[model samples]
Target: MSTATTQGGPELPQERRLVTEIPGPRSRELFARKQSAVPPGIGTTLPVFVTHAGGGVVVDADGNSLIDFGSGIAVTSVGNAAPRVVERVRRQVADFTHTCFMVTPYESYVAVCEKLNALTPGDHDKRTFLVNSGAEAVENAVKVARHATGRQAVVVFEHGYHGRTLLTMTLTAKNMPYKHGFGPFAPEVYRAPLAYPFRWPTGPDACAEEAAAQAIDMIDKQIGAENVAAVLIEPIAGEGGFVVPARGFLPRILEFCRANGIVFIADEVQTGFARTGDLFACEDEGIVPDIICTAKGIAGGLPLAGVTGRADLLDSVHVGGLGGTYGGNPLACEAALGVLETIEQDKLVERARHIGEIMLPRLEALKERYPIVGDVRGRGAMVAIELVKPGTTEPVPAGPIAARCHAEGLLVLTAGTYGNVLRFLPPLVMPDHLLEEGLSILERAISQG
Candidate 1:
């Protein structure tokens, strides 16, 4: 494996290579060490140990390079080790790492909040509170919603994924892995059906209307709008297979929330920061959520999540009630500033749309060729293909296909509660050729199946 920089000076190889089989020599040794050192509950998508990553490629310890389609589960939107992020983080670390935002506030933290307020979907006066992770952001959003409305109930969708915190786990619908074994979650969280057009018994437009009506009816009958604090949802369901709700669905829900005084929360942890071609996915439907939770890609692989929302709602919480030990570490805030700058200067939002333009046709062709490819959906760069058994709508778990693709040097992720969806979250800066090569590998894997 040769090391050479690209013409653009990004620290990445022009072409990918596989000098050894997956988990070869060095990776095997590292895996053995990891097995002994790391917790078993923390899962890995690929067995290979990542030595270096830049742009859309992850270099393994075994000297194999694979195109990353998962982007660290949608955390590295500006690409892993982007130059801007690296430089900013380095400077911030040298200055200071942490001072505890609660004790001594920093300019960078306030700057990040300013950027979030300016960029997040809403023209109203919005306040932002940075946190350590997506779950923390979700938990804080709940606290603010409850504090603002003096209500206890939070309404979330059936296939929605909030976080792993006790309160968020209760908000999440999945049981086996995320919520399993650690039962007895927090209370007063209600579940509603999302407008999943593929599975719902209606067309996209009608599915949106019906799902909204059903949810409103349920809220009135069961949870009562007055008792609910917020309605939380992912604009495009992330772990639930990139399920894009129909056009009118979010608008109708927003209308209901506004009329009833329930705070509308959009959990954009997976869809924010240009993953869905927009800075926030809610822009597509023209619905500005009252409270928007964001993380993942906000800080370019750093652990920084944010809760940006209506100023009044956020202000309702006591000043001391909304901070963490490392809520907005200096290093993370620097990274976030860099991330936002990168998105704008690099025009990654438009890049996401360009990726979709290239990927959609190829995915459509694959759908035509493979009987198992039941659906192709998602907006911008957050694309997914749902696999199902031929002649029937039964979900065909694509675990084996994903494994084979990983073995052949393509790192992909499976989503959906049934694990039947292959979701792609490639770096927005990925070169066209590399993106096409990854797609070719996907086609080969599916055709082989």
Candidate 2:
């Protein structure tokens, strides 16, 4: 990778420089090949193929640099090709690639589990196991919960996105792109209402109490609390939009879970590892869940997910039942350790909060200036704005606005069940000026839209 000087920093000169039109000739050719070779089911937000990425910029194959605000859907929190992650991964690659933890356990794997046990929320004696993706972590967490509690039902919230796997897709609420014709999904999964402040039938003030009461009442009456194995939720829902539940909702729901024997599982897949200004989003409310599923930001850009929770609950499962073929690959474990080191050394938690201080006010201003911006909400770097038509809450699709951003060399992502939420998860390492420029691009895009 090349390094250059910038006005603000002397490191990797991360800037938005458009050498050609957004999808210039090189990227268009690559995209054409991808369309022919890849399945139609797989979709891409930006057609530009990345050649090198670091800090806040993604350099496309055509030499155009786009300012990144999505952070690879929150995977590269420390930034792509982060120094620590790259060094560790390089060494691990030279030593060995995969031994499959199930066959031959390694020190790095144990170290990663140890870090997870100590880092995740809750001071209880915790145990951790690794997996390949967020969906696998959630599925395994559910498995352990069911085995420990001896229950068959799992409760999840509406507008919550777990993953794309069969069971996770069943747990997911959105129907179109995620679940359409994908079912019949796994059974015994029930959906509960989320305390979504903006869309709650009652106002934001009443959403917490009423939504929690209704959800608990539904579980009690419809699913039977005693029969429920787990209550899985995303502290701040990711793909469902960055919907931070009303203040008291999580605690209320957690109380109901404790009252029953159901395990409270926080799917921190998209909100963990300093993305939400805390090491984990659950810490914001001081809620310590029985099982916490984490992925995305765990290992920089490596494929690794972890399920960390109460030791007793995890130990309840049969010994051979929890092992996977490539669950804790050595390379990923090394990458995870490097990621942890980066989080600690770089003080990314504080950086995430600083990013929020920079972004939230700007987003709130957008809400004030644009009638199409219905609401702006989120914590730390994980922020979003829900789009709606003027004078009404009717959804205004986010696609046109996002397309405009892409054309202007800004990378952003859209979410929400109605496809109207523009979520921003900028890398914690992104410079302040780039953040401001990206937001300006977004403002212009919204105006044009």
Candidate 3:
């Protein structure tokens, strides 16, 4: 057995066994009930309701096991119901669910923060505060930056996704689903061009220097760097198509921010916690930020987020200024601690690199084989393929191909501003055979297209 599978320690058989159709009879029935009871705003990719999931496969309501490629949007990097996470969560839950960390804090919460402070990239003295979601972490990071600098304007990059809250929505570049019809967005948030090498207007070679220069120029002229509180961006763009900014792009932005005294905040929500081979994606370029926002893979499958930053920047805010009612709840904190342990002990960072080794070449091969595949890019488990019209740069919709994968028992996710990128975020704990099989399924779907 693979080390990852053994460490994830799933009791369920680690095999992709489709006993029935993808969205088998029971799943179809539940989805019907869901349609009537649940709000339409909540969208689902694969309609199969999961009964149990661990290791490489998710068993649906009808006992059909499917290969898990999405990892619940990169939240289950340690694997669903991972042994350590499950054990810790159970003990914490049995002891106490929520005393409201604000009302009565616990040692687990403090422990989780300590882990965050030590683990996140940076040798400087740091402090960490927990939150319920990535949006809250991001919102609070902005608050800290603004409070520390006494500045109003914030700069963000194009194709970067912060979150769905009002301020974060304004920070995000996508329109449909996230920002469409959601007007009256918060002000003082300005967008700048990202060094998206694949789609850069001036082409890939000049993307790094040009995009950085353009962003700095825009901030200086429009927003005025002196007036900017923070420059927030994802280390690897997540929902905006897993776009890794050009090699020199991030370092340049960091230099600009350092010169201007503007806080550089890395929203490492999707790309954090071994998803990008590095523990945090920012570490890949050695571009440490003043404030780092983390969520997704922080607590295994539990909902928890963290803002770990320089002691000076975070401490500048008032004592009462940076907390929430359920922020750092005991159960979630314990889960987070377990997640950290699993990552370190299981060596998931190396596993993520190995997954990249498995995925990138196969995806690159697909790009060479198919005209629709315009680009194949990403660092580790967080890889993607951008689809375009044959012989042109025009984007081709990824919906049909993704649906085909769903029908064939491969759970995949699509992203991109133009809805043309197929992103694959497989769990680090996945077995090798399943990874290869998932790729085969995707190849068939694309070949059909």
Candidate 4:
């Protein structure tokens, strides 16, 4: 409840200051330069270029401080330029950057894996290997699963988002941006129904059981469980919308996986490392996944991911079968170690829960006041409000309202397959004042809409 004790490392002014209009002269000029230099395919959610950031605010090129509710798409949960992260990276960079884990190896890399094995859900002996991104981690997990199970089929859910790589694109559900013209995807990938209470034809009370049964049945009848390698899912769906599956959904799915001998992979890329009230979102169900793919918050702000799972499954693969050139880069590994330490020392897991305690009530209030807000759901700081038509579930485009928030110097983000959800991933270390101010801006934005 008290963020005054939060130390944002860089000693940045916690107060938000708007020196100019959004994307004022300097940022607009920078955007023009970026447009000229960068490819159009590389899109940006906002045109404001960041000059510096720390605590809960991002200072743009125009010297405007905007409250950051996005956390670089959930990358900087420990806060940007966290002291421990910077110190660790500084030491690692000075000594050496990369020696390639598979070749020379490093203690930080092994330490990171050890921490992951200890922190992730299950107690069984686990093995871990690092990767560059969430997509890469998912891909490698699938590879390990197939190799271990001697099966080829991988099942994902509708409204799920894996990544941008070809295989990940195949695993992802939505089209347009992720999987539109990029077809000729990997074969043997199957789709199942998500326990999305908001869109389920059945009501929430019976939705979990119904959807889980339907999904398992489809997989059994269509893909044949024996042929399946893994059932990959996000514990709390991310880009698919911050849709928390109904209570029994994940447990039912995990139960099915157990009976079928299928690997249950919890893709906690966006929800792991204290973003949720728990250390890992899957813990909320007491459902331990056979394989868990993690990234994003694993490192303070560094690019690093890992696949931790049952030792036998990971060990089943041949020696040279796993790992990447930069999979366990020393810098990223050190940064990850720092992140874990910060989480423990700062008690960020508890902080995330406290954030939820503050945010959920405010968001629920908004849902009640605004007809456009159809639902407000999420755990911890990972909260969102789904926008819809006045009296219906029909999506109301969220772009305009999010734009208003941006114009008012609040950095929020839009998610969901249909882009009708506004997700909040505020830093756990964010001061209560910033949190309340950001919410006020959001309320004004939704009101303007």
Candidate 5:
């Protein structure tokens, strides 16, 4: 009985049990229905449809409890349907659902903003506004930066993922899937090199100095520092394969933003809310940005995203400049409030550190045993292992390896622009044995391959 699996917590049993093969019969039937009804553009990572999930496992259509390592792509960090979140959302739903914050204000929305202000780094007077998704929040942040600075250019980094919308798609660096055939994207957006330590030409030690100098030089010569409105980056790159930029890379970039008048934005959609040990990943390096974009883990499992920044920068936007119909909906706001309370009360930040302690050594040992394991990196609970060719840096296909894990009961997610990294974002509240079980399953997958 691990401490993470409590007697009073999510009542579902905390173990992985397969009643049938991976997609079983019921899941296959549902998949048939899904294929008929849903568009092909919308893709799913796992084939089994979920019926119930809690603690550390997802109960699929066939009564099989599969170990969850994805956490709904980092949306359910507090664990699916956390008690506090459920209670708050249920109460809010019973009272009211959608009042449209723009039309009529509510306390929950303001309370969530207040939490964002207090929780996010920096002691400066801040203003927070809500949106329905990470893409919308990022779009709003860009709008504020451009308007406040009266500048036209925005700088992004290579191996970064913003979102799926027009501007965000332009901001995103990958091609093929995210941006293929969706060209003529928003202009004046520049992509600079990221301080990717694993692949940096100069090696890890010089990665920070070399990469930073190159990025700054490119922006200064090509984009002109004065014309750039913002430098948007992720403290820990998410969809780009959990790439943690080399040390000194972020600080130098932040320094450049401060010297110039560019708004420094940290998109914490995937790394915020205790997923990275600190409430936000920026805190890990003691770096705080002018504007912060947050979403994925903010509201337990509800849809909520926010842009919080210095009052001067955010307020510079004229009245009626920012908002949406479903932005900060009451139920989501209530759920966010519950999530904040749960983080503080449960001390999940420490739990993230514990998960890392348990995972890193095992993964590093795997790297020693398998030549295909190129690098094992990340912080807190947001860890990943990059796979490559036996004797070189070249990446081999990660799809087949992931499929092997899926064929068994373990649910894992693959990332990286090259598509050769396995990212693990387990719930902080998952029982220790389950986490141990997941690692074992992953070991089996790698060994078999």
Candidate 6:
């Protein structure tokens, strides 16, 4: 790997290198060990074994360095091995790791919640609850919404992905991988069609209105609005191909929820904390959801998730109803504080916008060059290019193309319900030149295909 330098940071390598094959010898040995030790249900996106990471690069066990565009599925927005996060985590680990927030509350946990209440997109006085993962946060949100509103039904979009827990799995739309045989899911979860302009009718504006109308109509016809507790949606669908809804769609839905006394829940697990340019994607639509679910990038790379909402709504549940034993582990909380501070001090939000500016045009150029490039859409740095048949809009599973890219050392991820979308979630801290280099690799891989 050749060394390159950003403006002020330490110099790092620019090009990716393949020492052995894709997995290399060490990775194969580890894979065999993982297969025996790890659960069969858990899966890996890439076969490469990582040894260390920093900035935008992930170093593998075989000494090959690759640019990280996936960011651990949009978790490491502040970048892998961020200095601030590392320092804070090191200090926190020295002080304490866990005390069970429920048994003995700590200042760090409360401090993190304070940041969420202040940072999440809402002007009203808000409260927050820290959780272990995205699924736990979603489940707690449901519990709070149900307890506060005395309603049971939750409306989720058709292509939405909540989590793997029983209740969240029911809230999720996909079946094969997420819900496959996890049947008899939680009750009171309803699926509604989202405003997917690429597939459905209605222009951007009209699509938003039409989806809201359909949802309202369904609520009236099937489940009365009074019986519904919350309407959960992703500002930009994550696993569902980074689908950005039509203009005014979210606002219209928010209005419908307000009119019907239904809680509005924005699932920002994959789109929050500067991953999509803005600190929160809902800010783009000028819509403030009653409840906001966040994870992934909340703690840089730590496992932490939270649900922030209006103070009254969050406090509606009794004291004991909202906590877990390891809900807000001290180390994760400190890391979250560091992540938030870095986002502000380092100006990573604007950096994410810069990344978008650099990436969007390249993707557009690719779309013009290739007939299989059906659509390119995203906000800020969260972008995706969907693959389709030459003439028809039918999704084309270019998993092979992705595999080839992986073999060549560029790690990319495929999304969409049909597994045809190439989603990009590079760390916001990546240097512009490094990002361009990764994009060049992507273009070459696509061109060869």
lDDT for each of the candidates? 0.89, 0.92, 0.92, 0.91, 0.92, 0.86
Error of 2 at 271 (Å): 0.4
Per-residue lDDT over 29-106 for candidate 3, one digit per residue giving the tens place of the 0 to 100 score: 999999999999999998999988888888899998889999999999999888888889888888889988778778
- lDDT tens digits, residues 301-324, model 6? 888999999988988887788887
Which regions of candidate 6 are displaced past 4 Å? Answer: 1-14, 202-205
Query: Which of the two candidates, 1 or 4, achieves a greater TM-score against the reference?
Result: 4
Count of steric clashes across candidates, in order: 0, 0, 0, 0, 0, 0
- Residue pairs of candidate 4 with colliding backbone atoms: none
Q: Model 1 compared with the native: what TM-score?
A: 0.97
Per-prediction RMSD in angstroms? 1.9, 2.4, 1.7, 1.8, 1.6, 2.2
Q: Which candidate, 4 or 6, would have the higher lDDT against the true structure?
A: 4
Query: Lowest summed-lDDT stretch of 10 residues in model 5?
Result: 1-10
lDDT of 5 by residue, 83-127 (tens): 889888888889989989999999999999998998899999999
Candidate 1, 180-248: lDDT as tens digits: 899888889889889998888766658988999999999999999999999999999999889999889
Residue ranges of candidate 2 with Cα displaced over 4 Å: 1-11
Q: Where does model 3 exceed 4 Å of error? A: 1-10
What is the overall TM-score of model 4 with all chains considered together? 0.98
Candidate 2: the clashing residue pairs are none
TM-score head-to-head 1 vs 6, winner: 1
Clashing pairs in 5: none
Please provide TM-scores, in order, for all candidate models, with all chains considered together: 0.97, 0.97, 0.98, 0.98, 0.98, 0.96
